[model samples]
Target chain A: MLQIMEGSHAVAEAVKLSRPQVVSAYPITPQTHIVERLAEIVADGELDADYICVESEFSALSSCLGASAAGSRVYSATTSQGLAFMAEVVFNVAGMRLPIVMTIANRSLGAPLSIWNDQQDSLFLRDSGWMQLYAEDAQEAMDLHFIAYKAAENHEVLLPAFVCFDGFILTHTFEPVDIPKQEEIDAYLPAFNPYQRLDAKDPISFGMYATPDYYQEFRYEINAAMTRAKKVLREAGAEFGEMFGRDYSGLVEEYRLDDADTAIVAMGSVCGTIKDAVDEMRDDGKKVGLLKLRSFRPFPYEDVRTALAGVSNVAVLEKNINIGSRMLGAVGLEVKDAVYKNGTPVYSYVGGLGGRDIRRKDVKMITEWAETGRNDCFFGLREEVL
Target chain B: MGIFLRELRIHGRGGQGSVTAAELIATAAFKSKIYSQAFPAFGVERRGAPVQAFVRFDDKKVRLRSQIYEPDYIIVQDSTLIGDVNVFGGMKKGGIAIINTEKEIEGVPDGVKLVKIDATSIALEILGLPIENTTLMGAFAAATGEIEIHALEESLRERFPGSLGDKNVAAAKKAYEIVKGGL
Candidate 1:
């Protein structure tokens, strides 16, 4: 069904159809609407789920953990400060392999107390062993949640997943979204079959303290499951595309990259503008394409390398920065690492920080700078210094 | 084509309905069989923060992906954003610029037609608040004649519900009359 929906509302709708058995929430900026809608759905009997109003973000994830451990499909959402508050619980959720799906409306964590968009909140938790998927638009935000649930629950990849969408950019923007029918979603996703459930009949010990001898293996298993998840993500995305006609490749997506000497790399909403820039620049006979990073974790290193094999220059536009080290660098460092040994030149750019609007022309300028194969800092500096 | 493929830039304060006004115009246009798109440029500006939104409407399937760098028309709900952020930047030649301030705009860019209306006064009188979004849009229609006042009212009915819808329609109608009288 086609509907004019807010980004967070669309995400909530997708979560509803995914049929999470437990919906736990703590109100936070940018992510409030999603929980608000989910609460309404549960309240109105539109959805048959336990909508738990938790005391804090910590409890929100903890409640989800408790539900998932008891073999219930779980869903939750949080933003910058909320995610920070729940950081310890986030690792525990992943460590327990509970397969909880969370939507982190990306925002800047701050001492100055900003409620705007920034990737700092989520990026900081990238190493927590959860599969991270970044959504480019409202429609993608809606669709990826299903993908997250499917991928996370796969027995080979019994892990949690985080779908990050820009705060207020997609969350607040009103977009025309093609909501998939419930039957189609059902066809794509099967019922949750948790690998291990905490039933009294089975009586399996969970979250038990492990000594140094076994602790390493448990950590190793988490690492291995993440690698397996990369393949699972691709398969689930392919299956989803076959069913609903929307393609989501983990790591990266190429837009008009054929025979192009220059490639502009970005993630999330900036890709929308970059595609427009690429189309116009191609018409003007500039050989430019775009690479959109979708899956941030398990950082599709090989795919990133393969996509940019022929291009002489690649410009990476990072919304969040790894300040103090390389300028305009992503904390993951996988994009840079992709070309490190392969011998390709990739320029990094940090633009549109703190909710600054990134325009098409700015993307075009970044493309131009990369095409010249010249390197200098281009931060899309918002103010002019006298 | 009811969708005008229009790119309108609206200027107002945070609580003044600049974004909402842009949405209403797009909604009204879409109701008239136009494919409409609307987006607001939001910051941390609180209740009285300067804000803006861009709207596009077209009869055909709109594929142009660029933000409205060169708006075909401009609406100023607060009028104060005009000086703060070059509100007239990249306005098309012969484009309509509508402002809600009582003072006349002088030294505007050449080849641009300007229309000034006291929409804030009208909104304060009618809605008892200075949310000049519908009123400014009404002034927008009257000055540009891009849309009929009746079409806007019909759009309000489609976009809003109950007495709130009726108030918005009345505000839009009154705004149109102000523009019609002033112009």
Candidate 2:
């Protein structure tokens, strides 16, 4: 049934339907509602799962790691500084090869202390070996969680996953989403079966300290598994589409790129605005398209290359800046890497940082600039006083 | 789907039901079978601050998620919220605007269709509170003619679940009659 619901509530509902055996979460703004609803579900016996109320975000992930290592499907969520607090455990979950799926309500970190939406929290952990997927809206946020769980738990890709949604934007916004019945979700995702566990009867040590001799191979194996996750993401996303009438491109979702002269590369909520801008631009005879990154961690380089290969020009919009690089990180540079040999110029934009509103007109203007083949461009900024 | 995907900009001081009104609107929308998304954009998260909540709804699944920069319709719960942020920014050209204060909407900006009601008075008469969220929904139904007043009442019942729902439904009905009478 269609129901009016906030982004966080949608995520909580998806988590319930996913049927995680263990859930541990520490409350933080924008992210709190997800856990609150989950806790209520557990308390009311609406969901048959253990809801561990932890004192901090760090413990939340740590407890999930324990549950997952013990062959139980584990879930947890956090935002901004709460995620930062759990950063160490984030890397641990991946290294231990625990198929834990986490929801990150993407928010800006604070010094002047803001609880608003931004990509900094999740971006900081971009290299943590967890497959990160950025969701553009509530429906995608909820759907991506299901996909993330399936991909992470695949035997060939037993890596942790973090499905991110913009704080307050998707987290607090209400929209109609199809809540797949629990039985449907169950049919799509099988019960968790651990490849190996710390069973007392079988007694095996996990995460043992490795010296320089063996550490490199262990690291290589993790990287190898991540590479495998890219294909697994594609297959699982296709499977998700077939099961529930929604099609997911897995690594990236492309819109109107075929025969387009210029394009915008972006992740998360801003893509929706860009899509609107692109549609308007197209109506006015501008060949503009949008390339939205779904799988950010495994980077999805090959898919990105294929998507942008035909466009005459491409511009990447980064919500979080690497500060002082004067270059786009991750998605921007990756797109450049994909098309550089083909001679197509790709521009990079660092915009919408710290929750500064990114508008559609800004996207239109940037796309117009890219068509001219300039070195690069910025959007929505006052002209430099210099 | 009781969820009416509406992006509402409420203009009120710290104490009014702007954020609460947004939440109630979302709760009521959810009750309607449409998914309602509501949130206040407050720097301090303080009361008496300028606040806004965005909502989106569709009979089908909604995928393009972000703040409703472009609203199909806008409800200004407090007439005061008009000048704080760009309440009219990104509103559809022929979209609906429902306001609370007694000011004639004709004096307001011209772009989208505007509807004004004495939401405060409606609240006073029905719920005995100056907070005009429930009352405004009635005006919202009248102006936009999107969701039926009965749907809003059903939404209130689902959200409040007690006498609170009963009072809100009464406020909605009274406000609905006033809005319909004007039309």
Candidate 3:
């Protein structure tokens, strides 16, 4: 049935349906509502799970890793500073090959202490060997939880997954969502069955110290598993689309790119705004399009190249900037590398950091600059403030 | 405006229930079988700090996720925010501004309609407090005709419940009648 609910509640409902055995999380803004709702459901006996109130974000993820290694499906959530605090455990969980699904309500890292939305935190952990899936809206965020669990628990691809949604923008917004039924979700994602276990009867070592002889091979296996996870993601997305009505079968979703000369590539909730701008620009006789990168990790390099193969001009609108690099924004740097063989000019435009609004005008201006081959710069920068 | 997509921005201080008002409006629109969404501008706002909330209504699923830069209607829950913030920024031409003030406000942009209601007085008289969020929903229904008065009242009752719900419903109904009577 359709019901009006906040984005956080929708994610909670999806998690409830996924039937995670253990949920551990510490409270953080934007992410608090998700864990709070889960806590309520657990306390009310609606969801039969252990809702652990850990003292800190590090403990929260560490506890999740412990539960997952013990052959229990586990879940957790965190944001900017909280995610930063748990960075050590985050890398450890993936290295241990535990299939823990975490919700990253993307927020900006602080020096000025801002509790606002940005992609800095998740993008910063791009090298942590976890599959990163960015959600464009509440519905996608809810659905991706199912996909994340399904793909993570696959024995062939036993890697952790991060389902990221924009802080406040997608987390606080209320919308009418068609939440899936428990049986439907069960049909799509089965019960957790672990390939490796920590039972005393047949005990096996996990996360032992790797010497120089075996460390490189273990890292190579992780990279190999990550490559296999890309295929697993597509299968899970296709199965989810068949069960539910939304198709997320691709690493990148193409919007009106078939006949366009220019395109803007983005991720998360900003893609929705870019789509709106693209529609308006199309109506005004401008040949523009959008390529929404749904999966940022495993880096979808081939799919991105194919999607932008026809467009002469491409713009990467990113929320996180690589402060010390010449390429500036992370997404732009990756896109430039992906299409370097095609010799396509990729413009790096950074905007919407720390909850700054990226309106239609900003998108239009950035796309126009890309059309003119403008290079690295921040959109909507207040020069006077500098 | 009644049939097309409509956007609304509500300006209020923290603790004045502006966010709740936006939710209630969207709920009322949903009750009327219209696709709608509501969300508050998330910030570290303390009590009595200036805040903003937004609502969108459409004939289909509302997919735009950006904040409302242009709104067809504006609701000022705290009249004092008029000078402190640009309450009327990017308001559509011939748009409506439903303000919760007894005294008339000045400098409303030309071609935009203005409707005033003493919602604080109505809340105090009917609900025994100065929570005018529900009361302003009544004015929104009366001025815009986008949502029915019964839908707004039903939403209020469902939100508050019991005697508190009854008091809020009475307050909303009184404001609805006042605004409908051209007050």
Candidate 4:
């Protein structure tokens, strides 16, 4: 049944359906609702799980790692500063190959202390060896949780995953979502079966110190598993599409890209706005399109290239800026590298920082600017403020 | 009746239930078989500070995740917020403005339909509190015809169960009658 619910509640519902044995997360804006709802569900006996109220984000993820290693399916959520706090444990979880699914309500890192939306936090951890999947809306965010757990717990791909949704934009927004039934979700995503876990009878060592001789090979295996996860993600997405009506067939979803001369590539909630702008631009006879980059990590390089192969000019609209670098935005830098050999001029436009509104007009203007060969620059920058 | 999409912006203080109003309206729309959404501008302001919430209704799912830049209707839960914020900003031409004011409002832009109701008084009489969110939602349904009063009543009952739901539904009904009579 379709019910009107907040994005956070939808994610909580999905997580409950996934039947995670242990959920540990500290409260943070946007992400707080998700954990709070989970806590309530656990307290009310709706979801049979341990809701650990950890002191800090670091402990939240660390506890999840410990639980996952102990052969329990675990989950956690965090945002900007919280994620930054958990950075060390974040890489450790993936290095240990624990299949913990975390929901990253993407928010901007603070120095100015902003509790607003941005992709800075998760993108900062792009090299953390976790499979990163960005959600475009509440439905996708909810669906990605199921898909993330399924892909993460796969015996061949025993890697953690981050299901990222824009803070406040997708997290706070209420929408009519068709929450999948428990049996159906069970049919799609089987019970957690860890490839390697700590058990009293087996008594296997986990996360043992790696010396110089074995460290490089361990890292190589992680990279190899990440490379294998690309196919796992595609298959999980296809299976999810088969179970649910939403099709996430490709790692990068193309919208109106065919027969277009120019296109905009974006991730998370902004893709929804870009799609709207693309529709309006098409109405005005502008041959524009959108490529919603769903999977950011395992970087989907080949799929991105194929999606943008036909377009002459591509505008990369991202929320996170790579400060202290010539490469403007994190996603933009990756897109430029992905299509550089194709000779398609990929212009980077960073906007929607600190919850700044990226309206339809801004998307249209950015696309037009890219058409004129305008390279890397921030969109909607207040000239006077500078 | 031929409307494909309708957007509404609600203006109120932090404790005035503006966000609840947006959710209730969206719920009512959904109850009426219209795809709808509701959300508040995620701000860190405290009670009595000005805040805004938005709702969207369409024949199909609402995919636009951006804030409602231009709304077909504006619901002002607190009349005093008119001077503090541009309550009418980005309102579409010939749109409807449903306000909870005891006195006649001034400086409303021309070509926009206005509906005024003493929702605070209605809430005081019915809910025993100055929560005008549901009251204005009632006026909105009666004035704009975007949602049915019955649907709003059902949403109220669902949101506030038992006696509280009964009182809110009564307040909503009275406010609906007041707006209907005024028009």
- Using DockQ, give the best candidate's number: 3
- Which whole-number lDDT from 0 to 100 does residue A1 have in model 3? 81
**Stretches > 4 Å off in candidate 3:** B1-3
Listed in order, the DockQ scores are 0.32, 0.39, 0.63, 0.61
lDDT of 4 by residue, A229-254 (tens): 99998998998888788887689999
Task: Please report, as a residue range, the 10-residue window in candidate 2 chain A with the lowest summed lDDT.
Answer: A377-386
lDDT of 3 by residue, A49-156 (tens): 999888999999999998998999999999999999999999999999999999999999998888889899999999999999999989999999999999999998
- Interface RMSD, all models, one decimal each? 4.1, 4.5, 2.4, 2.9
Candidate 1 retains true contacts at a fraction of 0.24
Q: What C-alpha lDDT does candidate 4 achieve relative to the native structure? A: 0.90
lDDT digits (tens) for residues A1-386 of candidate 1: 66555678889899989999999989988889899999999999988999998799999999899999999999999999999999999998888888999999988888778887878788888799998898888888899999999999999999999999988877876656779988889888888998999999979877888898899898999999999888999999988888888877555798888798988887777777787678788889889998888998868888888888888888888778776766466732667688787677778777677776677788888887777876646466846751
Q: Estimate each model's TM-score.
A: 0.89, 0.91, 0.98, 0.98
Which residue runs does candidate 4 get wrong by more than 4 Å? Answer: B1-3
Measured by TM-score, how close is model 4 to the native structure? 0.98
lDDT of 2 by residue, A1-386 (tens): 65566778899999999989999999998788999999999999988899998889889999999999889999999989999999999998999999999999988888768888778889888778899999988888999988999989889999999999988777877566778998889999989888898799989877889999999898899999999998898888899999998877458889898988887899998887788678778889888899999878888888888888888888888777666665655467777887778888878876676677777678877887788766654556667842
Chain B TM-score, candidate 3?
0.96
Residues B1-183, model 1: lDDT tens digits: 123456788877778777777767765665555666677775665887778788776665443433577888988777656668888999889788887788878657888988888877887888787777888878887887656677788767777788878887888888888778977
Better of 2 and 3 by DockQ: 3
- Model 3 reproduces a share of the real contacts of 0.71
